[model samples]
Target: MSDDGRIATDGIAERECGEPQREPPCEFCHIAAGDEPAARLYADEQTVAFLDRQPAVTGHTLIVPRAHEGELFHLDAAATAAVFETVQTMTDALEAALEPDGFSVFYTSGPLVGTVEHAHVHLVPRFEDDSVSLALSRRRLGESDASELVSAIREYC
Candidate 1:
């Protein structure tokens, strides 16, 4: 409700990108819709896949659901299924084109992730030098909490 979007924070930024609450205005939609310039990798009537401008690698791509749901889990069942298909297709394209050591497909949601208002999947190619593959430090998380959380997750599922 203020300049800082989070009421309480641990150094998260208030995005001044001027996007609307539940949906970004049509510029990105247009870019996603083939009306603007983007390194489009794959597209169809219901989805679009394109390279990230601030890419982790040459073929780092994002596949966005055409309907705006704002988060991955918020997507309807069919949309979720479609996003997985798109991710697989895009990842394969990136591998064949750029040939990285491996690939990581990420779906970032919630308040701290998916900075945009639309649902999207990032197809980030993992190379040996990528800073993203850094190990999680045990010091940052308590052993008990980690074990309990993993147990809770398994139980819930």
Candidate 2:
């Protein structure tokens, strides 16, 4: 592992904050490769679940693919399915273990919204009055604006 806590893999080193240098390995890849130490929750052939070092809540968990895929869109159908299946299992186990008021399952795809370059699903355990707020700002879109946006999105879909 590098001094910044990133695992050195494929001849690249990662920084502690998930930054890569020289096409460095992503943090998830390091963790998946067993090059870095993490509080592992579960693992299978295609996916692995582990406790987040900087957790939103006490039981925050991250689910990641075994192969290095930086973005959610980069994953194929089988990889996507495998990751979500592990997520489902983790959610069930977290509910049993923590018994929180609710839960939030989220995925961060890009640098604008996510810190890690590697694709990951976060299973955040939420209580009634938890400090974490995953809420997004609300806005009521006008009919024309909403229709336009929907149409634009549907083009890619």
Candidate 3:
């Protein structure tokens, strides 16, 4: 963080006072800035929504912040809110347009981040028998273990 209140991520400062910075190498950044081609759906000053090129479902969409950030934790409050707001808007549009049974909303970050360094939220419209599956193994934790994990995470908060 700088004295003027810009948050830095991946050695770059986003949300600057004037024009926001974009990474030329990041395809999402170029798409958000209209430099690269994307099947754009919705766009605002803070965010841009578009169809995912490699979609998991028929109505798979991606919502990304206009500024470059590799992870959601690096985004400031305004950028965070903007990303989610666009997600909700896209979700509603997908529901009305595609009429899917449900949706799988997620984002990859940290060690699990994708090839594109820019942060993006995925809105995958799910159906009854679609081939896509997001099922993950489940594990039961003892009460003490769960409580300890909660406390450990809250310490950062």
After superposition, the stretches of candidate 1 with alpha carbons farther than 4 Å from their true spots are 1-27, 138-157
Model 2: clashing residue pairs? none
Best-to-worst ranking by TM-score: 3, 2, 1
Model 1 lDDT tens row, 1-157: 4454623234222335543322124445666656589988788766889888898776778888877676777878887888888888887777888889998777777778556767788788888877776354665778999999999999979
The TM-scores, one per candidate, come to 0.69, 0.82, 0.83
Model 3 worst lDDT window (10 residues): 16-25
What tens digits encode model 2's per-residue C-alpha lDDT throughout 71-142? 866889999999999988998999999998888999976768887778889999999888998779999899
C-alpha RMSD between model 2 and the true structure:
5.7
Clashes of each: 0, 0, 0
Q: Against the true structure, whose TM-score is highest?
A: 3
Cα lDDT of model 1 overall?
A: 0.73
User: Considering lDDT, which of the candidate structures 1 and 3 is the better prediction for this target?
Assistant: 3
Q: Tens digit of lDDT per residue, candidate 3, span 1-157?
A: 7555776566555664455554335788889989789999999999999999998878899999988788876999999999999999999999999999999999887766587888889999999989987788999999999999999999999
Q: Candidate 1, clashing residue pairs?
A: none
How high is the CA lDDT of each candidate model? 0.73, 0.86, 0.86
